[model samples]
Target: MAQRAERTERTERADAQRNREAVLAAADALFAASSSPHGVSMDDIAAAAGVGKGTLFRRFGDRSGLIAAVITSRLEPLRRTVREVQEATGSAPRQQVADLLDTALTFKIDNRNLMSAAEDAGISSPYQAQHYGWWHETLRTALDRVPGVHAPEFTAHALLAAIRADLVAHLLDERKMSPEELRSSLAAHLDNVLGAA
Candidate 1:
């Protein structure tokens, strides 16, 4: 009897893990495909995942928690890319800074819906995010290595501010700026901040 119970527990754990993955995948896909991620409801995610509403609440706490989880899972690869850029040997510090910011900006542009959903769910400030500190530290370290950078910390904050999710959305959606134009403007602004090498 005890052995059977142990097997059942193991099976239940495996099932729960599968459910979690299914929920994350469903939410990620739905948000990515939607024009307005905020329109996505927990019911929609639960239905798409083939899980019960109670399961979602039990696993992710609430809508915000679920969105946060989905975003975190999506960001894992980008975080790895940032680490690779930080460790690359041939790139100069200024170039590294540009690369990091560009990488993040690209992510924001691609995932603007997910980001907007996060903000609508009350996580509006990047500073409050768990990953924000990592980004700030990475950029600050790179900025510190640059020749003419006077304030690495503040400069890091300023550069990150330039690529913030809402700002990117406003530029692309409201202002109708092309992605190419935005990238060029960011490069030019970075040049101004970093000055001539």
Candidate 2:
């Protein structure tokens, strides 16, 4: 009897895990498809996931809460990449800075719309600020390794502002800078400003 109960518990756990993955995957697809994740209704998400509407709220609480979870799920990869870059020691500060810049650009390109939607959902949302804090801390860690850098936190904030999606999009779409040139110029600008190399 105990063995049977244990097997049942395992099955329940597996089902719950599968349900969570489906919800997150459906949310990701829906969020990407919609103009904003906030634009997607809970019912729409449930229909997309093939789950009942009640299940979604039971699982995620509300639209903003679900969006936050989805964004957090997506950010794991970027966080992992930052960790990998940091673990790779022996690069000069300039090289580290260059790698960080590339990472920042890639992250912005990947997550910009999703984050914007998150912002449109609510002002008190913790998603944007938390993400900025993560990136800023990652940059600060990399900057701290430099031999003679001053004000690593300030430098991190500066780099973030300079390479953020809004600024990059404006520079590319409005000012007509190609991505490669923007990257190169910004890298050089940081190198000059931060005295990295």
Q: Best TM-score goes to which candidate?
A: 1
* Candidate 2 per-residue C-alpha lDDT over 124-148 given as tens digits, one digit per residue, 9 for 90 to 100: 6342566767878878887887777
Q: How do the residues 1-197 of candidate 1 rate in per-residue lDDT, one tens digit apiece? A: 99999999999999999999999999999988887867799999999999999999999999989998998898898888777756766898888988888887888889888887887788646688766777898889989999988899999999998987778888998999998899889999999888866
TM-score of each: 0.93, 0.76
Q: Model 1 — which ten-residue stretch has the worst lDDT? A: 123-132
lDDT accuracy of residue 91 in candidate 1 = 91
Locate the minimum summed-lDDT window of 10 residues in model 2. Answer: 119-128
- Model 1: residues with Cα > 4 Å off, grouped in runs: none
> What clash count goes with each model?
0, 0
Instruction: Give Cα-based local distance difference scores for all models.
Output: 0.87, 0.74
Q: Candidate 2: misplaced stretches above 4 Å?
A: 35-38, 123-130, 163-185
